[model samples]
Target: MQQDAVIIGGGFAGLSAAYILARARRHVTIIDSGTPRNRFAAHSHGVLALDGKSGLEILADARAQLAAYPTVTFLNGEAHAAQGTIDDFHVDVAGHEPITTRRLLLSGGIEDRLPDIPGLTERWGKTVLHCPYCHGYEIGGGPIGVLSTQPMSAHQAAVVADWGDVTLFTNGMPEPDEETLALLERRKVSLQPGTVDVIEAGTCDRLRVRLKNGRTFDVKALFVAADLHRRGTIAESLGCTLTETPAGMIIATDTVKATSVAGVYAAGDNARAFGNITLVSADGVMAGLGMHQSLMFSGHS
Candidate 1:
């Protein structure tokens, strides 16, 4: 009826926290809504030791390994609301009984908001992608395109240029600064100053970009630095302050992953500016260890 921690997600962050807490002989329950941000990504890369595997495969392996721990439970449900202080938290999941825990870890991750280009959404995570570290190697040395949605899109294009021939499409956004323009010219990255109407991809993996000015460019991959937002509404309800990053405003937490709200912690994409899988997992470990130490110091264990 009682648990040491309730993790409100099932992604790399929540799984890592639950695994660590369970190993410490703590009762931990992870409530997930069965949707991860990387679901659309066919293969997950850049994570050490498990590179180039499907996101589902990595999660399945993690779940299988965590099943051996007796203190961990996975609930296929969403945490609708949370109540009580840190030492005593009550979580309500839709269509399920409420769960009580001594601490709460929120790793609900974020949602990526892509541009309104006609075919870009459909090709997301496959032909139209983000994060060079995650998908760059797979599409390396190929003709790549970067769709400009924000000011940072130029920077993303510059970094991704190292892996392929780069093209920057200003999708109704302003032009870059003099320095940026010079860099693009020096790097031989073409700049298309027009709105993108759609992205066309064939079954054979050929990708094409159609511009509003009746221009089309051939490319194998497209990089979009989409906007990000928290997937859950619980953080704001709990009065957790958010700090703005290049992607979005993530829940502000200290080095140990403790949020402003005492007794509640955050990890993964929800708490970190750079929300890579490896970084998120490390944040979860730190939060879990910190929670355990707090419990031990309070003589709660």
Candidate 2:
């Protein structure tokens, strides 16, 4: 049986799109492996009304609400492969029958590649965070550490300074040039040229940052600019266009969330570089609209 649409990844973006399609009386199937990008975080922030709720909790509630629509079907598994053209896509699942759909949405999201530092990975989403707007208010205005992962870390430190006192640790990067140093001085962002040896849980909700030189600093929280990568190969397998961003490459899409390939769309972190809960939800909405519009008009002429 051919579905109106097959959405890969059942996170906020995919679920939001599914809701839209379901409301329109279209048959939609969502394939999700059950792991979300923000699963490591205890509570999600930046979204109105539902602030501080765990991502999983919000998703659970969403799933329950989506159950009201008979047009939506849920498949709790991964999409192993996707092939075929617009209006004739065959998606092979891990342990289920393949699905045929008129339109495809890629919302597999992205994965964060944390720096190779001890104690940091264990504290991710807690003591070690990525977004200031999401976790800064809870962290309060205290001492904060920024571990440099790429050239963008300098700008990241400057932005994080708006939340707390910031120290940019240039783990292995070369020291900033003269002009860059001047900007850091103006922003009051301190530079730690020492290579970080380890990160440890400190007293009073802080992290102990130990330098390879044996010097240490205790900070209320540590901010890191982690490298982001797309989670799966479904988009590439279908020959969708990928756009390069400072963090990584994401699926390229037009304003309506339609990708370069006809009958295909992308949403969530996989489609855009910058995202929080609200933005990805918006992506889902646009993708839903784009897919539905295409489905309605494609048969004309």
Candidate 3:
């Protein structure tokens, strides 16, 4: 099959891009595996006007709205490999047929690498979350715990302290410097210096954090500094340059979402220095517009 643009991934970024491109009269096909990084998340927050809606609910609403546009199609498959060049990109979807497009938008997003502790993975996006902006308000002004799994976890703890009574669980990590320690002390954030054994659901949907010392802490929520990985392998195989930053390793993109490779654009967590639901959606919109403009200038749109 052939189209004007092929968007890989079906999260907020891919859907938003498809919506915009379809509205602009472009024949766009979104290839998605239907497993967004936020699938584990119960609700999406920090999105303007839709702050506290479930991730599935928001996507369903978006899909219903985009259904009005006839130029758009959704394929529930993964784009395994992409070849060819600008104005003629060929994408291969695993277990399906290949497709050709004039341009490509990758909104593949990323996955959070949670700690090895038991129950953390199962509780991810529910009791265990990452971004304070996204899940903090829902758990506002309660006993919140931050699991220090990365070097920057102390900073995360400091940030979450603004919302509620905070506790920093070192989880075997070294103590922070005097400056960092002072900051925590000044903020009245408690410190737990031991490895976490497990996290289990407690009374009233709270989380019970069990440390190695057999001590337990009942928290309204827990924030973990999880390592993130790009959701798709196609980008790396296609020669897209990945860069490491304080936030994490992500695909490098310019102001317009153009990647290191021409004819390819990246959006969402894959391209963002800081990943958030609202920001990812906005980035997708911008990348869609940029891709559209590129196509128009080249006389393909």
Candidate 4:
């Protein structure tokens, strides 16, 4: 049977959409490779009641709850390709038969491309992070390092000062203009113009930021605005409009999460340049409602 909707991800956004669809008795299939963007983090914050739960744990709970719905189905695999439009979408999985659905939802999330620095990868999502709102509170105020990845680093450095004594590591980037320097000075952000050499764990839950010039600064945590890229090509394959945001490219969608291509929706990080659990979860809810309304009015299924 052709599914009413096929959500091509199983993270927070995908699962949340699935929950809503299943509640409405829509036959939905979720195809996911199981590699969520926030899998590296041990805990999730800024969520309503589920704060402090690990992201994986949240997914686990969501999956378990979704299992209670007979209309929801899970497929643990990569969606290799996608085609067709509107009420007749086709998705190809890596190891399974192709799926036909009346609607498609792309929530595959994004991939963070960290800089080529030794020890940075291992520390990411732990001591190294991106958004201050998501992980800043637990950092216990002061001694936070911002590793410059893009021009936005200066702004990030200034903002993070609210959570800690901020250090903006220019890391070979151009020096901030006088106005920006003055802003940083007002924010009490320290500027380090040296290029980064390496990052390593320091004593007592701190990170050691070592510069190429042999200068080292120890901090409770490090922040970086890593370059983000969409994880899957299904949205592109289906010719959905993509928007370029300050964070990166994302699937462009309407307020209700409907992509440019009718009957195809997107939510979560794939649809948003910057996102957190709450925002992406709401994206899923909107997409679910929008798809359901489309189905009901258009009589697709």
Candidate 5:
């Protein structure tokens, strides 16, 4: 019977929960795999007081603050397998001992499948961005390109046009409905219909997208809704119910981040339908309190 609250992911949401739990004098152990979904992003924006800080810097600062709480422990490894139930979960860490805890926080995160375009991976988080609100201001009203991956790209083009010159590139994505196309036209978003052949790095950290039809557009940034895939088999291994959305299947959690399975909680990207750093960090706070209360009341069971 272990007493520590185990947080399996150590990203923003993961760390946020750990700090709150530790402050309450609850023993916490955060096991981080060190593989971040946002490792590609140079700076994490829209976070108060932490804007423009690299993802690495933000995590380092978070871990530093948690150090003040002696009960919080940090381990580096992946969750190869997990067993047991809430308030009594066992997590096996590769190259380390198994962690058995009183409560589990599954925030391992989601993976982004960017379009298979050359030069896009390198420029990601720098020039090739995803959320307009995240990286739009940095582009500063310049030429922007939106690679249509889902039907939402039409809406993305219409919304992003406010930031700068926006071009809707439908690289063989599903054709938008007539109403959506009409809305995009009204927004003054230029439409290009062709498969992107190659994306090359350009001067001044710009991007050059060449099409199969021998067309090109050099833009300051590229926006995409990369198909998201959940990381690891933690949710599945825990017998947690998942919900399906346009994006992908995600661990379904209630208002306080309680999943369908009891004694198991989730926060951050893997738990939410949509999320940003600020939003997920808030989720972590709620989850931290929720787990603490559950532990305090479990003796009544």
Candidate 6:
């Protein structure tokens, strides 16, 4: 028997899509690795009514709401490979039975690789973060630090300047050109050079950044850019085109969320560059509708 849809992730996007499809009387299966990109964040901000809720808390609520729908199935494992075609696809998932579905939705999400700086990874999603809109307000008016990893970091520092006293660290990257320097100086943002050697926690939520040049600075928090990539190969294995964006690369999809391959849809970070809770959830909704519309008219086409 074939499911009406098999969503290859059960994060906010995948779960939201399943709810829509299940409500439409379609049998939906959500295959997730049970680990999401934001799992490391103690709490997520700027996320609608759920703002400030722990990542785990938000997911628990989503899963609980989805439980009422008997048509939606969940498998806690990773998807291995995919074969066959639209309206008759075979999917292999490790440690789970194989699946057949009329439509496939890839919401497998993405991974963020921060620099291997000592203690940097441990502080990420806590004292270290990105996106002022998502986390800046919570930080309030305090000392904030921006670690430069890319050429555009000065721009990032200027943006984060509104949150607090901003310090831009070149961190072994290029010194800010005169143009960028003038802007940060105008904003009263401090600039530091040399690579970040270590990050250490201090009392009262303060962070200490040490440089190879033997310079040290303390601030309430630090921000570093991370490279984002698709978490798995299911999308590429099934032949979804990839595209680059300002934030990161994403799986390419049409407006309705259909990929280049028929009956295959993509949502969440896998399909779009900029994403948050509200945005990615809507991405899944579009994929759900796209899948349904295609199946509804398949008899005639």
Checking candidate 1 for backbone clashes, the offending pairs are none
TM match of model 5 to true structure: 0.96
| CA lDDT scores, all candidates in order | 0.86, 0.91, 0.86, 0.91, 0.86, 0.85
Between candidates 3 and 5, the one scoring higher on TM-score is: 5
lDDT of each residue in 130-232, candidate 2, tens digit only: 9999999998888999998888888888899988899999999988778778888888999998899999977886899999999999999999878888876
Model 6: which ten-residue window has the lowest total lDDT?
Answer: 225-234
On a 0 to 100 scale, what is the lDDT of residue 192 in model 1? 86
TM-scores, in order shown?
Answer: 0.96, 0.97, 0.94, 0.97, 0.96, 0.94
Clashes of each: 0, 0, 0, 2, 0, 0
Least accurate stretch of 10 residues (summed lDDT) in model 2?
A: 292-301
Give every collision pair in model 2.
none
Candidate 1: give its CA RMSD in angstroms. 1.5
Q: Which ten residues in a row are the worst by lDDT in model 4?
A: 228-237
Q: Please say which candidate is ahead in lDDT: 1 or 6.
A: 1
Model 6: per-residue Cα lDDT over 182-269, one tens digit each: 9989999988778889998866778998888888888888987777777667777888788987667888999889998888999998
Which of the two, 1 or 4, has more lDDT?
4
Q: Write the per-residue lDDT of candidate 1 for residues 227-294, one digit (tens) a residue.
A: 88886678888888889988888999998789999878999888876667788889989989988887
| 24-87 per-residue lDDT for model 3 (tens digits) | 9999998888788888987777778887788888988888888789898888888888988888
Error of 6 at 298 (Å): 1.8
